[model samples]
Target: MPILIVEDDNFYAQRLKEVLMDFGLEATLVNSTQEALSSNIPLYAAAIIDIMLPNDPDITGISLRESRAGYLSGVALARRFRQKVPNFPIILFSGYFGSFEGESWARDNGILFFSKEDGPGALKYCLQKIGIIREVKPRVFIVHGHDEHALIELKDYIQNTLNWQKPIVLRDEPSSGRTIVEKFEDFASSVDYVFVLMTPDDIVRNVKEDDKRRSRQNVIFELGFFYGQFGRKSGRVIVLHKGPIELPSDIQGIIWIDISKGIKESSGDIRRELKI
Candidate 1:
């Protein structure tokens, strides 16, 4: 089902649309309250309405004074929509800070209120809450470095033993159409969880000529990207390492599973944590 987005700003509406697409969802954009009110409300999975909108001068049923106010146009449209679909999920969003009154009213009316300043994270949270985004079989994106055999084993255990869906295992090189970063972002955004395997792939020599084993640079980059995208406290991220690998000092507080005991032995802990 497509999501309905009502926003007068073309750029912001397009940005929200991109975010929805990233989640493998579709969206329909409307610029005015009149357009939203006339749409087929039952067709949308959910509605995202912007607080400020231009006056719909030609709207017949709504009063001109009310339409011209702009600030309450979204609220008015939402109320009208509720008349048709009383229990539909509606999210009211505004970048403006002085929206506590509207937010309170929305809460009283069983609608969600989000601030654009909170970024696309707020939109994602609302979508999940309204059942637009389903956590059916949680997909995990596995990022590994130079440990092809170990990576395949982990993927098999996650899918067959743990009974989780097939984990996303990307090729080392990007395909023809897109850059590596673009492909990574597209794949990462679609998954609900991340598993990073830090193996002793790269060897670096110190000033004293002592060599130390570490994970590949790409693996470390992916770990940081996922951490930043889903906050450290999200618990959606897990780092699994084989040996004594050098980790970034900044990620000291994050959880890391030591696989030195064996991947099979450590699999139970991961399965339990993921509720699989």
Candidate 2:
């Protein structure tokens, strides 16, 4: 069922609709309380009512000046909706702050109240809590070093082959006031899975003075960090190597996909493991 959005402001209403669409929800927009009251409430999964709405002549027996000032029109609509479909999810929002009375009424009537200044993310969270919309899509963090070509290919595979949205790719240069490690940790926390591209980017001197090729220290650090967050056995972390590279002894048993085999085959394996 589509969500019903009652707002007088066309721009704000369209913005709210777009936000809901981002969460994979369908929404119906109406500008007036009269239209909202006349709408088929049962067809809507939920209602997002703006506190202030344009006065409509069809809405009789209500003082528009007092009702609009107090934002009682939305409350009356909610009550009417309850009479029709009890326990229906209703969210009341307003751009005008300082509506303690309106908020109290909404709380008493089991409706959520949010200020426009709180932004759509706050409203989205409330909708998620009430089970009106699904949670945001799972994200995969792509950890790479100097191999931009391989990183791009792997990102494309995740988006095209695995049907996942854009993977997280950190900037080459760190932003001001935040260390590289801090940025990686912040990004990792938001993602459900991490994909490490262990391309041969750095060479190090071994104990015997022989040159050893390896992925960048940053890549290794991020891989270990995600492993610590998700655990090795959880299968939420994946490593793909372009060529032979040295790995720590602690990660000996962890599986690593060889992209040298072919991007198609390697992406397929990763996709299956991700269940996408």
Best by lDDT: 1
Alpha-carbon local distance difference test for all models:
0.80, 0.76
Tens digits of per-residue lDDT, candidate 2, 74-190, equal: 776777788889999899887765565677788776677776755564576569656886756557789889987788788788788767768888884355678876776566666
Error of 2 at 30 (Å): 41
Candidate 1 vs. true structure, TM-score: 0.57
Q: In model 1, how large is the Cα lDDT of residue 256? A: 80
**Tens-digit per-residue lDDT, 120-237, candidate 1:** 7557766876788864666789999988777988888878886778898878435669887788877787676788999999998899867888899999899988866664545678
Candidate 1 shows a clash count of 0
